[model samples]
Target: MNNLNYGIIGNCQSAALISEKGSIDWCCLPIFDSASVFAKLLDDKKGGSLSFKLTDDYRISQEYLWQTNILSTTYDNGVDAFQVIDFMPRYQQKDGSYYTPPDIIRFIRLLKGKPQFSIQYDPRLEYGSSKVFTTIEEEYIYSQTKDGKYDSLFLYSDLNYEDIVNQKTITLTSNAYLLVSYHEKLSQQSIDRCYLKFQRTKTYWMDWSEKTTSYPIYQNEIIRSALTLKVLSYEKSGAVLAAATTSLPETIGEVRNWDYRFCWIRDASMVIKVIADLGHPLSARKFLQFVIDTIPDKDEKIQIMYGINGERDLTESFLDHLDGYKNSKPVRIGNAAYIQKQNDIYGILMEVIYRQFVEFETTLENREELWTIIKGITKIVEEH
Candidate 1:
């Protein structure tokens, strides 16, 4: 579960890393910046995970849907087999706005044989510290943290939960979909709406792929990299995260892991260039505006990075409760490099300004205001 065998899925609002072994090993609930609700990627025992797996022996294989970010994972043994199609629903709708929801869709189908499946629905909240209370109603298993921002979680499915409280396998005779969702707002979506959203999401990703300019021969690789950037871009803030995950040691037994969840001006300057070039100038536009808005009034030190919400004080700290990934010590979070004296931040940001003003040739609504801020940044960079 701790290898590159996992696939990343997100709706820009939140993201999860699911192991091909049928476990949702890493997920930052509610939002990408929030503490993980299921963090088995960091701490196997203390970090929580939810798994929907076939009960018997099985071999697993996984791949993303052609030209899209939707992941399809298949598990089969000689005796029986099944396939679980996993995705986070994200798409543009009639209003030209996205329908990205914080939900994990597991579309399970009995592929070749009668593969009895089991579910382990253990969720650790508040980074596995707060007490979680779970309740079952009809076909839903809902869990709520004591005082966390995540009010409650709902798992809506078509499977029978008559004897599910104690963790057991239920034989499957038909296909079904399981949705592990966040917040009460999405919980109100009917089972019919859930199915409809799934179809729409599949079409949405495919449509996006179809729209992308196909390359010569590396078409698949190009689409994948482009789609990954799209997933990491937070639509709400116009800020793109470095990565969806945090605290997985780069080198085993070395404390080199760092949280890459925030938007770095240095990073976004280039990220916006690709996103804009690929026909999504809205993100580049938004990120450029965000960078301008975040510039201080010639007094405060312009940080190298900021939270998606524009928070400045990113104090680094270490969590001691759980074992690190592969026992890599001193699992850390809240990158302290924001205070670094890296001059590249200024250079990269200037590159973005060049694209926005020169390459795009688009009229800026706040041209004077933005120019003043740019001049201010120049002054600071010159002196410091």
Candidate 2:
């Protein structure tokens, strides 16, 4: 379950990486780089995990649903088979806005025969230290942890349930759904309504793919990679992260893993070009806007990386409670590179600025002022 081939689902604000076994092992709330609510990817014992695995032993396979980020996991044991549909709530509203609530939706569909599943709803907050307390209701379950970082997380299921802390095995032969939310204790959308949103989510993603994905050769590879990038992007501000999980070491027993939750300017600038080449020019343009908004007129130097909302001071910190990936130790949160001197970013960003002129027909607003800023930055690079 700790391997790298886990499927990922996101809706701009946050992301969740679920293992092929249908366990949500790594997920950060509010945003991608925030403290992980489920950290089983780092430490299996103390790390938080929510399980939805089949009772019967079977072979499992997972893939995206027809050019979408929505994942479909199938389990088959010759006679009996079932599938788990996983996706975040995201679809275009009729008012030209998006209805992307902070919720994770899972639909269990009986494909061939009856399937039974074991349920484990354990949520450890503040990087797997603060255990979440639960209150089980007639139809829904409410859980609360410490106040500051991720206070309330709830799960509403259509299945008949009584206990929250300790739960027994549940069997399902028909369609069922579970909606887990981070912000609100109760979901604004009902459990049945979540089913409709799942359909619309598939439609919305496929429609986006149909419009944006157009490659003659190596089409599947290109589309899947593009979809991964799309899920990693923060839609509200157009910032893109390097990866989802933090402190995952390259080699076991080696503390080589660094936090990659922040959006680096040099990396994002290149990603914008790649996204544009893949046919989503709008996304590239939005990332450029994010870069422009990060320009600090007052500070003496520009930050190499920032939060999705243009936050600075990315002071790195270690989580002492949980051991590092594979016991590498020193599991870090924020990136310390923000305080270092990164000089090559000017040329990298200038390359993107040149791309803006070539790829986009954007009118150069305040040409003289723009040149003045560029010249200033170039001078700094030369001086260094």
Candidate 3:
């Protein structure tokens, strides 16, 4: 693909795709594991996106800085040039408090001469399954859902929506700068706090990245992958998403589509091992704690998946109106597989707990419970 001037802005939970032209084509909201709010990547009509493109023809190329998750995209409109720097601030845990935000930042700068840019802030909520309520503000466009659970779509730039199209256009002079931030409901104080928090987040990422130990090989790729993995993690619960998107089609046009917005016990185990292997024991421990906290005591039958914050009862449904990705078929939401009885889950959980004990030099306080379950399993096996 010819390098398109586009980059990604993420909140370490969810992310948005920003073209060098200043358009947001993709963004999943509430959490990284949530369904797409702007899914133009899947279906253009049903899948909504925020797009910024130049009225004039532009050439673009994109790349990430070495060993860093920061994305840089360059745009050339023949005579003029500009660049966009995109990154999500990493959260930090210190003094028993975590510093982070559910925000995405886009920093735009003019590299040469002047360029005209157009911005479009169109958000399709619930995997493009729901229309968003748009409120045009003086400096930003506030898009919220009716239920008001997920607050999204704040565009910061010198642009105005034209003719109710939910788009804006701006002219950039040399050395001009623009910062666009997206977040959920935030008070005036919180918004100010978040702007400051953004700086601290940048520092945290840069510092943490500097302290990263060397890997044997593929160091740069490893760092990028590690960051991507971290970005997918739910800091509040330590659960990681399988991917940022759901129903993207593992195989386009196949029925193999599955909702991946929830935490999979299987993936959790793998994540623990990966983090441990990477010498981050604290992350693994937090993940274990999250699992322990989420698992119910009444039922020995462990669920195969849970919401990012350990929510249960995710009902599966289809958006029949919106066409599927590449017209694959029914676009599904929620997850039906949770109700299925997977016998191996118990075994997997037990194995993971056992491995954690060994690797972390810790003891299992619930050994009796585990032993009882194991004994029951053994009795059943013998009877069979």
Candidate 4:
């Protein structure tokens, strides 16, 4: 029987899929909100992925490390064995601010006997809708797109790809190891700088994971979910997406294709409650602050289903050229809801403010200005 297993490693902004045989099936980078670079999970041929597999038969099993987003998958080929570790570093508190790359890392280690493996690293640009240019440096494989609109990916692996047209194979003896990394577009110097950053990033994640408070049951799963939620949050704007992928059907071949690249007010409020219940009150407060900073006029006439860094303009459009997931039609980007009128925003905003004051012990320092705006909104509501 061929035993196959899978696990997930996420930075809370984005996530990756690691198979038991040491393959990375999916990953999106820079931020959870960014377009996918490796999207083979949606389309095997067109969508790209990073894959590592053995030439011979192997049995596989996978699981996440305790209370962390780190994942481990083991491959046993009768007498031989090996494992792959995958993780995305978490944000760190250094110099009173968080620092870490929005990248994914995978490490493969040999355990017992010799094993031959083939490594395939393919990256598609712009949600698998564009071609990518691949470059091979001394220790890294760089894949970049033309327009420079999306995040580039850097792969660091021992497997050489001098002639990428031809598939390459490598042999690993017991105790041997290989590391692969992904990052955004960077110059040669910038790539060189990442080596040091790799060490720092690993330490940062390990340290942060150490700080998490323990739970009695389902601790690992809960922490992974929490981290996933956290990564989906826009630290600068406090907006959170429902998910990373845009066209993944809630039901295959259905019209459930909705773009999740921007912040949703509904999801943000729900996240506030989730984070608060998880004992991360600061995160909830930050989201509230983001909401307050985002609303400019407070007139209640300027509300939307979603926005980008508080920008009221999100012009929705469709991409007719590229086929949708599972052949689902009409792949669309952006949101046109900003143009619509939602009378409920005024009451929702008032309720949010009230909830913040009561649950978070928040008091608006500019109460006079806030009340003046409230009076205007009340007048509008009364008149309507």
lDDT of 2 by residue, 1-384 (tens): 255678999987788988888888888876777677789888888888887655556888888888999988888877777788999978898898887877788887788877666678887777876767788865567777755555777788777656325666676667887777776554354556878988898988888787675778988888888888888889888899888878888787787778888788888877777887777888876777776667636235778888888889888878887787678777888888888777767777787666666766554663333455577677787778
List the candidate numbers ranked by lDDT, top first: 1, 2, 3, 4
Provide the clashing-pair count of each candidate structure. Answer: 0, 0, 10, 3
C-alpha displacement of 298 in model 3, angstroms? 6.2
Candidate 4, residues 1-384, lDDT tens digits: the string is: 022235666655566766555567666666655567776655667777777656557887787655556677787888777776676655566577665456665556678887666667688877776668888767567777876464566765444456332456666663333334445334442323443444555565556555556689987767677766765666666676666555655666676676766666655666667666676766666666666666546565545456546766778777565566667756666767667766666675565555656666555563444455567668878988
Error of 3 at 223 (Å): 1.5
Give the clashing pairs for model 3.
3-60, 5-20, 5-60, 13-32, 21-52, 22-52, 23-51, 23-52, 24-50, 24-51
TM-score versus the correct structure, for each prediction: 0.92, 0.92, 0.80, 0.78
Worst 10 residues of 1 by lDDT: 183-192
Clashing pairs in 2: none
- In TM-score terms, candidate 3 sits at 0.80
- Model 1: residues with Cα > 4 Å off, grouped in runs: 147-151, 185-191, 296-300, 361-363
Q: Which is the better candidate, 1 or 3, if ranked by lDDT?
A: 1
Tell how far residue 122 is off in model 2, in angstroms. Answer: 1.0
Evaluate all candidate structures by whole-model CA lDDT and list the values in order.
0.78, 0.77, 0.63, 0.63
Candidate topping lDDT: 1
Q: Report how far off residue 132 is in candidate 3 (Å).
A: 4.0
- Model 4 is weakest, by summed lDDT over 10 consecutive residues, at 184-193
Estimate, for each residue in 1-384, the C-alpha lDDT of model 1 and write its tens digit: 346677888887888898878689888877888877798988888888888645447788888878777788888887677778788998887899988878898888778777876788888877776678888875488788876455567777777654354577777677777788775553454557766877888888778777777668987888898888888988787888998887877788888889898988888778888777777766777887676667646565777899887879889888788688888877677899888876777777777776777766545664655677678778887887
lDDT of model number 4: 0.63
